[model samples]
Target: MKLHVIVPLCVLFTLTLTQQTPSRDKCVCELTHSEKAFPHDRLSTVEDDASKCNGNITPQKTVELENLLLGLEKRLPQLQQDVSVLEREDDGQLSSVLSLLVVENELLEIKQLINRLNITMLGYQRLTTNTTKELVDLTAEMQELETYDTMQVVKRQNDNRRLRRDLDHCRNGHQPTTQPTEPPHGNCPHGQFQNISGPRVYTAGEYPGSYKYGAWGRDPKPGAGKKSWYWIVFLTSSNKFSNYVRLYSSLSSLIVGVSTPGNVLIHSSNPTTNTVQGPNVVLYGDALYYNCYNRDAVCRFDLSSKAVTTLQLPKGTRFNSKGNFCHLDECYLFTDLDLATDESGVWVIYTTTQDFGNLVLSKVEEPLTLGQTWRTSVYKQGVTNTFMACGVLYATRYVNKVTEEIFYSFDTTTGVEKFNLGISINKMSPNIYALNYSPVDQMLHAYCDSYMVSYKVLFS
Candidate 1:
């Protein structure tokens, strides 16, 4: 009976194992292809045991094999779900790496564009510098030619006058008393202004009588008493910066300087439109050139027609409320535009931030148009005031109430700066608002504290 039962059970176990073999092979294949680690050694041992059971099988061994198969079947679905999750994570990591590479490429492109722009800007700046140099050279040549023409014309006129005088003497039947040879080049009708050997002091009550008593400038075009004109700017009682100018028939008279009684002209046509300011004023030809307050513009008042015209300054120009020029204790309002007239032409001296806040001298053409501008290497901060004489610029600095010194001289023709001048203004008010050099009488005019004073400018 035991032999019969054991044989039947063994046959039944063999058939059951044979039937499950295909399914077991499929599970092994899945495990072999998997990306995750699995126990291949255990699977191999189970296969060996199943093969050995075909020859000799026991109830205990059959039951153990069945339990192992059941456990493998139960774990299969969970293993597949784990593999799906791992695949998703790997895909995400790869996508993130690609995105980082794309961002890096974009940043590199932006850097390249910025470098190219910098190179272009460098080229443009170089071109502008070369152009400026050429313009300056051309302007100098033109000025020299104009001076030559003027000298020739003056010589011809004098020669004609001498010939006419000789003819008159011949007609009178008198030997022309040998006319004294005229001074060389008719330099200055009065001796070429003498250079100062020592300081000349002036107090509130004391002043030199030789220099027109109390006058602002050496009448550049001195002719008749009516031809030599002087002007004074006074702050209105209503507003300090809002001002009107008075025209004087003669600065030679002491009454005019003391009382400032003259015709009041050129008030702000429309005070609301623009305030007429006179930090500096240059009377040239037939117009009075001045800076318009609170705006980057210059105004030309036609003395004959009584008409006004404006010329715009460069953009980003500092003016009006912008305080760059300063003196001791106070920054003079409306000092930004320094107007001057000389043999060459009228010029406006101003400081510009575009040129690193350096002094810029621009020539004013007819109708208040801006012509050529020259940028000086000297920083504007060191200069307290600037004026032009015979096309040369003199810059002064505030030393004390008693003295102001000319420390720098700029030549517009050669674009050269010199520091050889040791000239100083003596015993002047601390608030010397304006300084102008006149080539006609060779004197320096100062407007300070409602007083107009003149000094003999000594040139060595």
Candidate 2:
């Protein structure tokens, strides 16, 4: 009986062991922890519950996991939308980069164009500079040539005049005088101006260079007991204006400081209105003619009556230092209106805006009327002084400190202009501020830097 019971017990024990053993060696849930895991069968409800209880998770952890799953579920569509937007932005970014590259290429082209323009401008500027220098040189050369041509013409004219004079003398059966003969008194029977002698008389008078601007000469028309009288008008007010004119019975009296009795006063006050304005003062026929102060007009101060008369100039006349006589070195201030006397009558030499700073001459008639006006082509500023003789206007220019050339002439009788008259004047001083021709003595009276100089006029 013992052996049978032992054998039965052993068999039961083996059966029990076989029943407790699993079907597979490992479970699907166990393999799920690895990356190589595969899905197989679902866990039973009781096992799922037991596995969750064995996971050591609390109630808070379960709620958190549920919220995480719900949040992921809600954000899945937004994530997909973000991916689409990023894909679109990639294409837009590529297009923007292409545009930037195009802009950079255009900028490089513009920079090259600007550099080319700068080079072109520099070339033009250099060309202009060279051209300007060449033009200046050519102008100077042309002026020199013109001067030479003028000298030739003047020499021919002199020869022709001399021949004419000799022929006349031969026809009249009289020997031609070796020297030119002086014309009769109050008669201009001689021919055109041929030459001018050097200053026959030069003296500073009583002033002795005390005044830089003034006019001194014998009057073309004198009253009784004033035939040999010489008058001087000193610009004592800042060397620009004057009011009194002093008279001397003779040039010797003027040199000896002998004051004559008829010292005319233009105005009692110095430099007042209607007083003498400039150094170009002229004493003609017992009257003083000068530029009216601060006006484009002429003022005539009568000595006998102590009366004043004014004659307005033409429209657009340049005065008050606007149209001054100028040379290469300097200009004479307030020489705009030049009052000159010839054998005919008193005349005015001025410039008008319509004539472009050229000379405009007009005859000043009796009773202060503007007579016939003559326009000249010569520039006023180029002349140093002008005078009238035999109804012809002669203009002088600066040559040297000791010489002045009379190179231009305008004939009112024939309306002819001659630019080749090369008569020269020898100067004791540098500048001649006031130059006037006297029909009475047939001389050129020049007020040159405070010196009164007279030149003998030689006619053919």
Candidate 3:
């Protein structure tokens, strides 16, 4: 019975071992933890086994991580550079903020100053007008009283005889007279002005509308070798100022963008004191004259000597854009002073508080002296541009986009004004910033929206 039981046990153990060996051969994965077993039913292929055993990481996921790392590596240099720049800028950040604050304060102060000046000008205008009226009344009364005095009449007759004798002697070249001479009136060498022809020349020069405010023309009284030369001054600073004068040997050179020997620097620094301040400019003789920066004065920049001279305008003259050329729609800024040239010489057109913003014309004499001044009835703000011809001041007004009308004239010779001249200008641009008549060529030179245009002056 013992032999039979032992044989049955050996057979049972052999069958159990056979079953376990095949199961062990079928296992494809192993676990390190003795307490855990691999989930063989959940995995069907080698890829599934790899994903299940390696914390759910796949070949595609591995490639994505590799690409992310490469991208970070590529951007690391730029990130480092940015950090360095931030570090450098941190030191000056406070100073930069303070500087901006200072600039803002300065701007505020300038605005305040302008407001104060306007108020003062208005007050002065009222006082001066009253005083002038009173003075005229007093003078008229004094004249009436003098006419009733016999002794005063006799004294006036004796004085008149002495003046006539002095004039006769001077005319006969008999003796040196001590009478002050009158300023030149620039009488018309040609016939009386009738009308102006169409544009004879229109060009944009080299800049080609890059600048909106500027002036260009041939000199009215050029130096010996500079008769054919032309000049241009662009208000490159905020369209209100410039520091140089560009010279062209000829009109062809000006149109073709040919560079001359060099440009004349009004000042080494732009928008500074004594530099050009407005678009109204004129090349007279051997000097360039323009409005002085921030002052009611005319500045002359000598081409040969490179020296600057200033002629202060009359007291109460409007400036700092308080007085500007205007139309019904808009006003041109920084046009308080308009420099013009004619057969006489250089003249300046401005407005004064005393004149109630009407046009005031003054002759600029040699050595930068103020000559005779005339007050006009035409309101300055109504005029767009003005030029002098034959001792007459011609003013233009905006008619439309394509037309400007010369509807007003003030004769400096006869102290007469005409408002129905009815002359028209055909424009190539919308605005004419500067206009002057060249006596040498009898042509009108206009700086119109960065274009240099010329028109012939037709005289009767």
Candidate 4:
């Protein structure tokens, strides 16, 4: 319960560009896992037998119905009935808008519990047990509606005592500036963290460059110094073809041609384009967003009009090769090992067909197919293991070294943990093959398979 070493800030220029050993000492990391033991229900039965994804729900049945509803702890009587309906609202300054409308009604009940996990992954195994007790009652009602955002500083100190006489007339017209606040665009200087923490395989953020090179996505231009980079990676080592889109060069391992427009066609009842295969890819900045595989809809590649347009999907996937677009504005987040159907609940493979694998998040306007949005069904929703800070988004179901259990986080703006990082994933055993996030240096880069390690998150 003690490990916070961290020291990797330029550490003499990262010991002259990587040789390994990225820790100088700060103290606050507790990872241990070894002597062999990393089963997560045997990696959810080997990703549900190499996922053809039929009736998804793995991560060992969402970590055994989230440890049988956290050992039947029943999230404090539904967070005391949402603090008694937020003390019957209407008290002034909205009493914190009734805990932000119970955190936006627990984000539409985690999108109706991701639409009841797509009817429990298409009724596979004939879902019942009251639909796995409604996925442990919607993850204990989205972690008691995001622990009421820790009472938002008691409503900003009750608006700082009614703005203490308009903050002493704006602090007697205070004026003394010389320019210095430019570090929050993509927010680097180690600041702009929404919230974070990982008991094992490290994670930390709040200022020092918000992580960029050590790890994190969207970075591929620039070469050397300040590492501003943009975005480009093409690691399809798992092997499966048919143009998923590729490009790289955070400076250079090579691989670069840069073309555009490829996958996006969920079965087009009106536009049709679904003719994709496997190996897919998607990125934003330097432009690259995938959908190919049997195309359930998602296309747009104008790296200077190489040409190709067909992005749209409001409801198309029980078979469209499941979802894509992990997370970010234009919407579109899909996952389909075969049938982890998503957007928010719906599972129906009975008697226990636990092959459920679905994840959906859509929103398309023109030529870019797919319309109407809102999704959730997480049938083993490990949408690329996920992690996004500040605008808030995390998802590390269970890491290891010592222990981990982040079911996911999202409400009070965003979150994704699935089990909550209290750790004890069946008695830990470290081997964090890889983990990343650096917003330039926001920290959270652990990799023990080849060793690099890091941490320091004090996120609220």
TM per candidate comes to: 0.51, 0.59, 0.60, 0.20
What value of lDDT does candidate 4 attain over all alpha carbons? 0.36
Task: Specify the highest-lDDT model's number.
Answer: 3
Clashes per candidate (backbone, < 3 Å) = 1, 0, 0, 127
Instruction: Please list the C-alpha lDDT of all candidates, in the order they appear.
Output: 0.57, 0.76, 0.78, 0.36
lDDT of 4 at 167: 87
Q: Candidate 3 local accuracy as lDDT? A: 0.78
Candidate 1: which stretches are off by over 4 Å? 1-225, 237-243, 254-261, 268-275
Question: What is the per-residue lDDT of model 1 for residues 382-419, given as tens digits with 9 covering 90 to 100?
Answer: 66778876566777777787777776767666677766
Q: So what's the TM-score on candidate 4?
A: 0.20
Candidates in descending TM-score order: 3, 2, 1, 4
Q: In candidate 1, how many Å is residue 413 off?
A: 0.7
Q: What is model 3's C-alpha RMSD?
A: 41.2
Q: Rank the candidates by lDDT, best first.
A: 3, 2, 1, 4
Clashing pairs in 1: 195-458
Which tens-of-lDDT digit does each residue in 1-460 have in candidate 2? 9999999999999999999997887655544432332222222433454454444333323332333333334334434544455555556677656555544543443344345445645665675576566556555654544454533776688789999999987887765545532212223455757788766666666667799998877788899978878888989988889998899755544544546564778888877889988888788888999999888999999988989999999989988899999999999888889998877778999998999999999999998999999999999999999988888889999999889988888878778788877778988778999988887878898888888778888886
